[model samples]
Target: MTQMRFGQGTNRITGTVVMDRRTKCLVKRIQPGQIAVIDHPDLDEVAAEELVENRVRAVINAASSISGVYPARGAAYLIRSGIPVVDRAGADIFCRLQEGDRIWLDHDRVGKVGESQAVVRGERLSAQTVWEKIHQTQSHFNQTVVAFMENTLHYAVSEKRWFMRPLAVPGMYTQLKGKQVVVVVRGTGYKEDLAAIYHFIKAERPVLIGVDGGADALLQCGWKPDVIVGDMDSVSDEALCSGAELVVHAYPNGDAPGLERVEKLGLAAHILPGMGTSEDVALLLADQEGAERIIAVGTHSHIIDFLEKGRNGMASTLLTRIKVGGKLVDVSGIRHFYPPKTERRRKAPLWAAVFSAPMAVAALPGSFTIDDSWLRMVWLSLRLWYFP
Candidate 1:
């Protein structure tokens, strides 16, 4: 492994190097001030948000951070967060440096400290460059959209089996017959929507099915998922042990990577082979389980959402929606639709007191000595209520 020494008086950023070709896995081992070495090409905003939340000091990408195939906003997110990203850092670094090695990144050079030569030097991404590239890509956005639509249509036809036939869903311990099921995915505005329908969740007591990391999202909002399904990469071990009935999504070939992890942890998980994203499988699971109503929270329903994820084809998602179309309800802006139950219940008592105030005063004699100011406040409230 080659090392590089910076000249005195020059500011050198130093941290422990943690490398993972998979950005999601790297996030688990990254510390607040550590340097993340990732090989994610066209890094997406979701991965960037996770890296930022972990507070990594800097990022070194073995692949192009923004490949210009799409406007992946991850590099821009890191730049905006004041975290430096060195893109196209040669793949040699993976062989040159091991995890937990002390490294220094100075300008365009990166390697171990106190050595003369750098292991891998690469271009440092700037906010300006990333912004320019994004705009450049957007200039040809119509072409990308056209390609995406073409892919979607092609896949839709190829994966029509999901809609044509009954889905083979795995059995679960959680009962779903005649019940409302809320399938949660960690998509856009998921947290907000969850908060909005919190009252419905409490009152209706829907069966909660979380897709991978969505399980953690449920836990974060103080709700326990009745079932958790996905590839199991993004979810934490803590969530895996939360006693939710685990369902591992398998490929058509019956390969389930998540099932191994579950078994290693001494937990049993049912493997279901289906063609679609984990979220899609989750909705299908609810429908197949005879759920009376299937409510989806934070799912991808828009063209832009698929585009943002750099997905060319949404065949599985489209087919899944078609399969469960009658039962599925995509939730958005739920906060506007319903207020929290506590707020509504609290207002009921206040309104009752306001309406009964005059009767109470009438029942009491002049000797009761009601304050004039209190009467005026009551009159104002009644006027506002009746007039408004």
Candidate 2:
């Protein structure tokens, strides 16, 4: 419980990195010469590489798995680079912190006014200044992403398995007809969505399913997924431990590197190696599993949602929509569903019991007197039964 002190004033945030967007991480935010913080637990390698190239001051893992469980490669790399990480709170905590809200690392190690301006102070920030820094950082990020994708694709192609089903396009998966299933995706407000999923499961009892990264969310909530379909990035070790059926999407050329991670986890998972995006693969699994109504928790259908996840193009998604039009029922907004409270009734059984007890007391009248404790118990039961 270390407290941070900040002058009651505002400061410039030149070197500060803001990973507030939950859907897709911002490359510019963690660019070189900036202090980086990830608002989500699941960060793709692409995002991690960008932060590394920039040499960020400190990284705050605002995800639930910040310290309780084993850290992911992204956070691990930051720690290895001598960049301190303080995982004090979840993603929601970022909204309260300001640009100059005096950040203290690891409870009280490195202290600084959490402002981006500190990035370009020469003595503090670095040699790169202004737009050039952004340009160079983005350039490195692009190259890294290309390399990462190539390596991933190579590994995917190397692993050939039966469950691996290659889709015709990305973001397009087969649809199901009548099986009960839930489509779990990473939402902006994931914790809230997790709560909703818990309630939804309690009421509907749908076969809990996770779409790629969402499997990790399910694991966080202590609900083992019945099935998991995705490319395999951003999913944690606990997710693989869920023992749910796994389907890996492969490229048309038969690349499915995500399957390799599944294998590395020492768990046997089904690989539906396909060419589609992870979401598409998930839908395909639902169809293959014969799921009836698909209840999606944090899926993205709108272009904005895709963009937030850093997708440059949407043709694949549009085509996929056309393919699975009927079977898909997006419940992205259903996170607000809460169970209603029980109502009180006037004709409660407690009143009948109360009257019966009084009659019994009257019948035993002239001879003996009932104990006060018994009378109190009767009155209490009457109140409880009569009230909600």
Clash counts per candidate, in order, are 0, 31
Candidate 1, pairs of clashing residues: none
- Residue 351 of model 1 has an lDDT of 70
How does each model score on lDDT?
0.81, 0.53
Error at 24, model 2, angstroms: 9.2
TM-score for candidate 2, please give it: 0.49
TM-scores vs. true structure, each candidate: 0.80, 0.49
Give lDDT tens digits, candidate 2, residues 34-134: 55555654343334545665566555555521222121244444444555445435544456555544553333223345432321111111112212333
RMSD for each model, in Å, please?
A: 8.1, 15.5
* Model 1 RMSD in angstroms: 8.1
Model 1 over residues 266-327: C-alpha lDDT tens digits?
Answer: 99999988787899888988888799999999898766668656578788888888778888
Candidate 2 global CA lDDT score: 0.53
